[model samples]
Target: MGPAGEVLWDVALPASPSRLPGATMAGFADRGRTPAGLRLIPPPAVTLALVFGPGTVVLSGAAGRGSVVAGLGFGTTRVRQAADFSCVQVRLPPAVAGAVLGVRPAELGGAFVALDDLWGRDAARLAERLSETSSWDERFALTDAVLARRAEAGPAADPEVAWAWRRLVRTRGLVRVERLASEVGWSRKRLWSRFQAQIGLPPKRAARLVRFDHAVHRLVAGQEAAFVAADAGYADQSHLHRDVRAFTGITPATVAGEPFLTVDDVAWPSSR
Candidate 1:
């Protein structure tokens, strides 16, 4: 472990099933040793990770260029190609995460696709350079450049969708979709379409993710089940358990007393 405690969220990629022709698969693992505490990572995910000890080079799988390191938040999705066989992972802030996906953190409930949709060849080259960097500062600078470009190239999010997002954040998972639509002067159908376009997922799904995110935060911070359930807007403790399992595939007890470390948890800090 680094400055933090033991690597709490270590998960290896599972083997792919045979019989699929030339199947390409990807997964991510987070080490809990970094100085950053619990993170709120969201979905429609994008990440490529490799672990290198302190003062080592980090590189992607291919020999590309123009790589950058970015910190993203929950509810942003992008395609990530891993660099370096092993390297320290970093946490992402919501803004950067939104920039990468060409959407805001408030809009992330769709499936992940290729980076080409957003970055084209530049993304591939960046992956290569990310794998080759020696200094973390250089990596971070490159990441900043990438984020800047993404911010420039990415489309502006819908004002109404953003408005709904602000309300969701404020409620801490207690707001309703009808209220959101009325506040934004949109029909439910119109709101869903606009929200999906800007944020990848529909409002209901986003709300669920947000609610689950809050529950995880409560667990990580060691709140009692009763309080966590109520504060997170669950119907009750059992409701919280059901939702937690749906997203994380684990029980609240499994994560209790430990800082929550799911991708969703890492992307949505406010929920935490």
Candidate 2:
């Protein structure tokens, strides 16, 4: 339990390896920490996260409301809060890149932005009401409604950006940005601009996040650290250590061994 009396769900990812082909596995987290100021927690890896319930609002530290609800990238971190209730969170696969970052799951590496910017006041209220409902069917209906609105409001897709994103995932971050730009036939600046507009972050940052996410999945599933590091494209164990520290504020070894709430936690899996 946290400082507040609210209970927390024992979050876990799906156990099936067959479901994940190029990215980390997805998980669900239901937490009711407190209705206080936002609390920032480092994820196990870079991922697209969804705030699926009411009362909760994710805030960005650097960009404030402007950065709160977007599909943030790998190194980005945000403060999370629930005004008077709890919230549910769902993780997205790394391969599933977002198209527009302002409100939809189509954005890649978008930062946390304001809920109002994405869902608006009415949608937010609907989510709040749905959170109090007991039936899964009701919840699903509410979710569908919200998704429909989001789809309607989402930004148009750019084939070039989509193609580049696909290539990046297929190559697992081994491909260079310049090569991607050339393949898309867009100037480097043009590519970056389009990517930022649609994905919230540049392609390189998204790629790194995806790469780190892959490494974390392997580590969590009992893979050897050294081998996982190599496969993830690190120069060596030390390079992997640096990458983790840069994004998560911890070394790979510490993360390999523990359940870390923040990047600073020791790298060990949870005792349970």
Candidate 3:
């Protein structure tokens, strides 16, 4: 129970070996009736939430307002319902999100949209399927199969863009954009345009987000802010503070205490 006597159950689902690359899933079940909500900090990957409970889950952010199903990518922090909610969160690489969600990452960048608006009737069918199933495992299986089918049916990202995204993640966003562009045989301008169109954020901002994600986790792990700043490639402690505030509207100390990040290591052990 929380201070408000709220009960929250968190379930982390292992990625099935058969699942598509660059996709991960988790489940959250909150039973509190306290009109609770949370500030969802923006991460590097695109996010999709499937809500299948009596409680309506509303998301307000760059993408705008929505309830039931929410889609967010490459944007500012979003506020979502925190109690009386049960849902599954799917994290997808921006490259594949366009294929799976029928909308480019750039379209949803820095905003929230109703999933039904994007997926149409398929979204309704999915909600019904998930709600009808009593087993969490069943719900996960259904979602994975749906995503796999959609991804296979939709167009894949340009090879150059996909390669660049992988490299960014591999290097923790420390690699130079120019270097990545050259390696991918794309001019800097070309890379920037395509990346923004496909992945939502420009290369430079994406790198910062990826690096900031690393630093935030370290802080949540109890590392000192100065050390995390230096290690994360920030110019100084103040730089880290400014970046954290920009992303989460909070200071590093406050970010270090976020329950969302604190539970991440346990829930997504291989998030890095």
Best by TM-score: 3
Model 3's TM-score against the true structure: 0.90
lDDT of each: 0.50, 0.50, 0.75
Give the clash total for candidate 3: 5
Q: What is the alpha-carbon lDDT of model 2 when measured against the actual structure?
A: 0.50
Once fitted onto the true fold, the runs of candidate 3 whose alpha carbons sit more than 4 angstroms away are 1-7, 33-37, 61-83
**Which model is ahead, 1 or 3, in terms of TM-score?**
3
lDDT of 3 at 134: 89
Superposed Cα deviation of residue 45, candidate 1 (Å):
8.0
Off by over 4 Å in 1: 1-5, 8-99, 102-109, 112-120, 257-272
Count the clashes in each prediction. 35, 24, 5
Report the C-alpha lDDT of model 1 over 6-102, residue by residue, as the tens digit. Answer: 5433432223221211111122233423232232234222332323332222222222322233321222222233222333233332323465456
Candidate 1, residue 208: CA error in Å?
A: 1.3
**What is the Å distance of residue 259 in model 2 from its true position?**
4.1
* TM-score leaderboard ranking: 3, 2, 1
Ranking by lDDT: 3, 2, 1
